[model samples]
Target: MSEFFAHRRPGRPGLAVFVNAGDPPLALLPELVAMLDENEVDCLELAVPFPGSATDGPVVRASADRALATGVTPRAVLDTVASVRPGLRRLRIALLADWSHTVRGTAPGEFAAAARDAGCDGLLLHGVPPRLRTAHYEAVRRAGLPLVTTCYAVSGPDAVAEAVEHGSAYLYLVAHYGRSGTAAAWDRKRLGAVTATLRSAASAPVAVGFGVRTATDIEFLEGLGAEAAVVGSAGVARMEQARAAGRDPVGELQSFVRELRTPQPSHTPADGRKRGIHP
Candidate 1:
């Protein structure tokens, strides 16, 4: 089983934290990574800063801007991962989508290979492109890198079901419609229903993201049968706040993870069969 899958089975949902490489500084990234690992994070998603980030809101976009200001590129992010790779055991690193493809060109295979060589375990293509043209997704998966594709509420439940049928290594469910926030804007009841339908059809793990800023947000997803919760803007924003406050940023992060890992009562799905955690 993949490291991601292995972490999600039979217990609680895996917490996948996202960090923008070069946000604080490239030199500080490895230490930040070590902090997350010490906190027992299941997987890490490293955002390779790009010039443009359409899917990201103000918080993430601002961080990306700062990273770009520091000249953080895809290569820089890979280098950071390479330095910390040897120290990790059973950890998966997923590279965020390439900016160029989102705006300019087609998906870049070489870019994916570069990330793989640098010890990245997967790829996260942010939005489900209009004409998905699964060629590149297939290429990266063939190379042993699981490509995660997201389906939002606006895409409708049918699209979500179809994504599962087509074989997403992981199906990203956007619970919230807009910017990352302290409270979830998504309709919990509706999202739960959609999640139920998707889980019934999806061949892969269904992970929730977007505006999932707190442990409470996670509890909601777990209840809905999601196997993983993606926390990005919240964690990154917290990391920045810690830095600005002159606190031990890493220590603070470790504490945050502990809160996330706390056990919660599982919810029985609508189908009556309890869904196993997606390790």
Candidate 2:
């Protein structure tokens, strides 16, 4: 099993936090990773910025813009990961990038090799569907790194199965059919159905993302049988908010993560049985 999925507990959902590489500056990455590691963030996703990212929302786009303006290239992101790996002893690190950023100008094999050497345990390629992932899979396989893929609710059962088959680490299920950051309310009924389908088909742990924001959301995901909950845009928004207020961004992020992982009270159902917040 991949280290990412191996860290998940059966009933409690793991927390994964996303941060864009070199968002403010690359010099701060090691400290940020160390803080996250100290706070029990199960996974750290280092998002590599590209000019044309279809999956990014306004918050993430702004972060990417700031990083790009400072000349944060793919090579720089990898080097930052390599430098910070020793401090992240208990955290599983994954690199999030599109195929364009992964390939750059070299072959996929060469790109995957560099990422593995940089201390990334897995890779998540955004916007690539499962049916079209054979070449990417082979390249990463040759490099000895596990590849993670996304499965959408609209993709239906067969697509979910195919995604699970192609994905070696874990499968990311889009909680809603949209971009990264949106204020739309989550449909619990629909999410339950989708999670049921995915759990039936997926052999590895299934993680939900794209609309998760709060501790309540994490509890809901745990109720739906999701192994992990990914918080992306909200994390970046908190960091940006702290920076604008002249407060320490890392401290704000640490508090936000601690709040997200804190358990809430569970309510009694119609059966008159009390259940905890998590499954």
lDDT of each: 0.71, 0.80
What's the C-alpha lDDT at position 211 in model 1? Answer: 74
Model 2, position 197, has a per-residue lDDT of 80
Candidate 2 local Cα displacement, residue 32, angstroms: 0.9
The 10-residue segment of model 2 with minimum total lDDT is 270-279
Q: Against the true structure, whose lDDT is highest?
A: 2
lDDT tens digits by residue: candidate 2, 100-215: 55564577677778889999888887755446477777888889987777877677767777778877777788877777897655666677788888778767668889878888
Off by over 4 Å in 1: 101-108, 127-132, 165-168, 182-184, 263-279
Model 2 whole-model lDDT (C-alpha atoms): 0.80
Against the true structure, candidate 2 reaches a TM-score of 0.90
Per-residue lDDT, model 1, residue 102, is 37
Model 1 residue pairs with clashes: 5-279, 6-279, 7-279, 8-277, 8-278, 8-279, 9-279
Error of 2 at 270 (Å): 12
Number of clashing residue pairs in every model? Answer: 7, 0
RMSD (CA, angstroms), candidate 1: 5.4
